[model samples]
Target chain A: MMSVGELLSQFGDKYLQALWTTYGLTVLCFAGALVLGIAITVMRICPIKPLQWFGDFYVQIFRNIPGAALLIVLVYALPYLRVMLSYYMCVLVAVTLIPSSFCSEYLMAGMNTIGAGQIEAARSLGMTFFQIVKNVVLPQALRSTVLQMTNLLVATMLTTALASQVPLNPADLTGIVTYINTHAVGGITAFMISAFFYAVTAVVIGQIGNRIDKKVRILR
Target chain B: MNGAHASIRDVLYDAPGPKAKRRIAFVTVISLLALAALLAAIVRRFYVTGQLDPKYWSIFLRYTTWRFIGRGLLGTLQVAAASSVLAFAAGMLLMMARVCRYRVLNAIATFIIELSRGIPTLLFIYFFFLLAPQFGLQLPSFWRITLPVSISAMGVTAEALRSGVNAVPRGQTEAAVSLGMRSASVFFKIVFPQGFRYVIPTLISEMVIVFKDTTYAYVVNYADLMQNAKVLISNYDALLAVYLVVAVIYIVINYLINKLAATVERRTRAAVAAAK
Candidate 1:
């Protein structure tokens, strides 16, 4: 068994870099997914028939495929279409789009729970459709679905590990583990360190989400 | 109230006038055309690259290809099935332990659940894969994937089962105990069955998640579907075709599982209503 000090001295820098990549990718993906999710939610709920069908189709297709497979497809398939992107960018696009589908569903459920009277009131006030959605609907919808959205965020964070599969930019923790396993003497110790980082981050995120949930919860 | 109020449909937007309808139709058509053009360009690229070559796809028709796919599919299914069953049992045990009267056991269960849930599934697999060799455990590669998948899944499964058990009415358990039933009997005979009924749909969906997660076995060089597809991709250089087929298989399997879950859920609801 490697001592804790020995483990840190040997693999600390790589583990730290991996931690940074994991959190950085998580933040980027979460933000991108939120924006895309809101658009998808709007498309699904808006009065446009074509948009609604498109949103439904998007959710059905993306949500059904496993994230790892989807990542593989995007990484390999995009170049064929003459669309070039770095491995990081490819991962960004795939991770963002995949979880956005679920996030949109959760947001739509929240939107559905908003009273029709609220929309009616906004309409009576001569609010435009976009205005009503932006001002009146979105805030309430988000507030109600914060916990679900948080769950999606954490799941998305976890999926960032799949990005390590991309050979070009394999900086994520899982990728780092694979690297360490081959090169380092105490590979198990190094992996445990990475696991510890991930586990701690997950716990912290859950706690923060719980705190935000309590703060933002709508009063009945 | 005297005048006809606008219908709810009109509240969001006035029914599109004839001109507005025409404009919407034109925009939709243009967008569809653009999308079609993009897809055509993609197909054209494949055509030019020989990726659409019949020779490339012919590999799927060969006996060896089928054997490879069959073996990979079996491996994936075996891991998924074994992990799900083991995880379900472990989850139930953990949930039972968590809910038991013993404080220390409850704390230990909670710690395990949180630690397991907090760690990503891939990390668990990696940890076990690396750890096994160091400990001189000459286990098969399948155990490496199965053990980690099962352990990671246990966290989620236990959480689901815990919620299901908690949702059961307290009175049912109390009544079972009042009948001079032992604690285990009260739990197993009365509470667990009812709770599990409420959670069957969720458990089924969790199984689908486990099935999808079997792809992570690729990390350990396990010959699951994804790993097999990777090998084929390298061998044939038909990356797009190989991935597309893999994605389609996954989508079809998941779609079927979802439909099954929905049907089971409806049947369970109907059964409950009938019992009432």
Candidate 2:
């Protein structure tokens, strides 16, 4: 068994790179999820019945599908359809799709909290449809969902661990741990290092989210 | 829709006037066509790639295939059920520790909860799978998957339980205390039972999560549904069809669980309202 110092000294660079990769994937996937989530939310809340159904269906399919199954489908099954994607792309897409559904659900719950009275008031004020969404709907929804989005961000990071399932050039944090474990007997120390990074990031995100929520929380 | 229960979807737009109604109708038709076109394109791809061939899907008709999958599903259910029970027990203990008078216990509980919640389940599985064996702790493949899945769910379950406990009114505790009940007795007798009722829905949703995590049973070489699907795929030479069916099975099961949670939630809420 290697000492923690020896492991760090030997593979510190790999760990750093892996951590960076994890961060990059988490941020990119989160951005992608937010964009898709907002679009789905728009579709779900739109007056068009078909679009609403599509959005609802999308959420149900993605949200309930296990991450492993979704990733396997993307990585293995898609090639059968002649739609091959890079390993990184498959991981990105899988993580993004799952979290986007959750993102939309949280946004819907946030929007629901705003209640109908506010929308009615906005309508009475002669605000245009776009204006209500822009000025009234989005601000409250986004504000109230800060905590959820934070949790989602952590969840997205955790989901990015699915990257270890596939081969990639520069693997994410979890992948790096697997790399170390396989190449050498990294043991609990290697796992703990990765877990520590995740825990710190989660705590920091939670703290920031609480601060924002405290500041912007709408008192009803 | 009733105003009291109107969600953002219902209230986002006003009751449409003639002009708005016409515009909405036009857009609906356009979107419907767009969705249908998307669906057709997917089916077309499946056709072009020979994925629509009966050879790939015919394996599903065999009774043995379903039995194999059913056996795998039983494995999955067993893991999920075992892990859920373990997680709930640990979670409740963690919750009690956190709310206890001992500061050290509270801090330890909080730290464990945060670490458990923050770290991914795969890492936990790896710890048991790769790390434990290093120290001469050999667990069965089932435990390798089940233990990690349960541990991964523990923090969230603890938080959920704590939330439920908080939702139990302060007056209940005070009243119990006034009746000369010990603090532990008050918590056990008057408080926790109500708290447990309030969080049954949350706990059920947690089960859905645990169920999903069990899919990683493949890593530990456990023959859960996905693993069984792999076996069927190998035998039939149908990877896409088998995996797709397996994925649908998972999604449908999780969906049903979620619906059950929502129903339980509503029923409990109504019960609470009636009591009030």
Candidate 3:
């Protein structure tokens, strides 16, 4: 029957640290996924048949496999090859690769919505392939997929909890929640506090994404 | 300059010339070689460690192993099946609340959906699992996992159903209303069936997610599929082999779900076309 203020005082600093880890992992994974997703999307839509097939294969395999399984495989199996990564790096790589598949699909859908005439118009103006992609296609594609990307960002944030399974880092929010549950008196209240933090962040992210979406639509 | 004549293929790039084809071939060969080398390294490591040994895999032949895995699979299916059913019902209610005329109900539904969507499935499960004892609910272990999973699924299902309902033309509802039918009857008879048909594919996909999410139960010490794998790992110390088996099982199950969903979607589309 601890008061909310007392519960906050008891475990507030550790909870904040855990939240920081969660945020850091989310930002890092989202950035990594964005870069990889762009490359995969480009590969999928490129002129080379093999590259296109490879991109499709990657997405299909990764998307079908459960993220938990993939994380286990990456974290456990890779170490046997003397390619051990830090906990943060392992979580980052796993999260990035898994969600990059979905992000590529979203981006590809966005790219599909760009009319053929837009590309032809760029070509007629003597824009090279890279220039056309960079200056004309990518901006619109990113804008179109902003909402999906935001969803992915929130998902990535949530998925960071899976990193608790990694033995090296037990200080993340999920791990902290587990610890508080075992060690503290008002554990459930602490968990609720943590859940509140995640919900608030998610809502804020959705709002920002909506605002960007609206602005992009207006610019059109 | 009419864009309607050009297709997606035209928007991608120009056709490859002979020189470009040669470059592509060269790049393809190099990439293939790199991939082969990577695979070789992994295989070699496994061979060196004796992870490729038949002895490690022989454990699966044991009846006890089968019993253990079967029990875990059953638990996973039970949680997924129960949660999906509850989630579907909750989603329908949420959708109705959102679409109802009352502003307060709409706002409340929207808030619940957004909050559930924003929170990760893991957190929801954790919150419920912990809070159950505090509130003296005396819920079973399965309910702890099922409740949270259903809450998250409800949010997604509600969104999908709302969009499906929104896609239905307003004229149909208006027509039903003008025919002297009660609004409730019009909703259940006219709006729901058609809207649900439109979202069957999405709902099936969400079920796959719910199935995958049952793995999170491992965190709470629930003996689901992933948790069983963890238990086997502790016993056998064959981490790679156990995880590979677990992953393949998951992939096969998900692939079947996707295949089934695709068939349903095709049939639905065919039925809709016939109706038109």
Candidate 4:
């Protein structure tokens, strides 16, 4: 993974490991975002308008604000308010809240597409509200939104790489490049390293997304 | 029983089902449960680290990170503004080329769009940043590094504009051409006015992305929020508190912007579509 020149050896796992830390932070942040995004989306679709507004506002801000700026507010400003979270936590928080807006929008559209006749039929049978939704509507909605959700999820994964800008240690594959770059310091080597890692990740995620999407569409 | 039948809406995609309330409730429950689990895990991770000291939080607040945040914000805005305009212009030019009788212009526009659409945006910018430095033509840093950020922004803005321009129909151009109008005026008067509406939501989304992308500056070690957060995280390891704050703020800002976009999308959709 390394040439181990004097400069590279000096930093050792220092730079490389930092890249790993970046990976960890990124994964955690997106994972959090995926979950939170789903939840906010659900809230938006619920029967309550108040909860919907709450969800809407959550999505709007997360969607609007710059990721870095948001990260700053979390990292630097919160402590001022006595609600300080760590940098890792801050990145996760930002990613989760922001991405949720996207997920909810996608999901709501899916929910909205379900035919009204089915619901009325279930109501005619006097089925419980939760049972009718779970057994009937969601299955249909899920079918329609599956391809879309897959795309959004993959896009979210790639976008989450932005977490690296929190100055990800550039370890892992990018670490090798980061290693070379710091040695070359201000050289294209670092850029190339990150680009390579990003490409690999993007391709992998894109392929997975495409495959799942294709499968979903086929059945649909 | 008589009230059971209500007037059905004409919109094709509007309704879910009659048991809408029940379905919504189910979705709500499942969503909350999952979110709760994620929050719990983060909390667990937070407590495991055991560095929730107020002294550290205080020290963290008093750091130079605030200055970096301000500067980083400015950098983010600069890139968003510049690239958005550039992207729109580029998109329009490309759109016109796509619609033009000239094969050469159409080919060029198609090539540009394909080249951009195929690549991961970050990779594009990373490469662009390298090349921009070579030419000494990039977004300059007024408060921070300008060139890198702007190039990245331009790439995305360009994509948005392409779509905007395409939304215009051939009829408008044909009418303009019949009036003996030149290509440039047709674009400015007929195509642009109509196309720019489509670009609005996309432009807003691009702006959000650009702002988010300012975090990319951290890769170059330019001080931005994400970069600062990482530094602080390692320096203090207050991962939870920091992330919670970051998530809330990002959500808050993005929420406002998207709301405006949604409002515009609704109004425009009604005004533009119904008129037809």
List ranges where model 4 is wrong by over 4 Å.
A1-39, A48-65, A69-97, A139-151, A163-176, A184-220, B1-76, B91-140, B143-145, B170-188, B215-253
Candidate 3 lDDT, A191-212, residue by residue in tens: 7777788889999999999998
Candidate 3 colliding pairs: none
Overlapping backbone residue pairs in candidate 4 total 48
Write candidate 2's Cα lDDT for B166-188 as tens digits.
Answer: 99999999999999999999999
Q: After superposition, how far is residue B162 of candidate 3 from its true place, in Å?
A: 0.9
lDDT of 3 by residue, B72-124 (tens): 99999999999999999999999999999999999999989987787778777
Task: Estimate TM-scores for all models.
Answer: 0.89, 0.98, 0.90, 0.62
**Candidate 4: tens digits of C-alpha lDDT, residues A20-69:** 66456556655676567666755554454456556766766655665555
Which sections of candidate 2 miss by over 4 Å?
Answer: B1-6
Q: Candidate 1 or 4, higher lDDT?
A: 1
- When only the first chain is scored, the TM-scores of the models are 0.94, 0.97, 0.93, 0.75
Clashing pairs in 2: none
Ranking by TM-score: 2, 3, 1, 4
lDDT of 3 at B276: 81
lDDT of 3: 0.81
What DockQ does each listed candidate score?
Answer: 0.50, 0.75, 0.51, 0.17
State which docking tier applies to candidate 1.
Answer: medium
Q: What is the lDDT of residue A205 in candidate 3?
A: 95
After superposition, which runs of candidate 1 have C-alpha atoms over 4 Å from their true positions?
A: A80-82, A120-128, A167-170, B1-26, B48-50, B58-67, B178-180, B270-276
Docking class of 3: medium
lDDT of 2 by residue, A47-128 (tens): 8899889988999999999999999999999999999999999999999999999999888888878867888999999997
Question: Which regions in candidate 3 have their CA more than 4 angstroms from the true location?
Answer: A121-129, A167-170, A218-220, B1-11, B58-68, B262-276
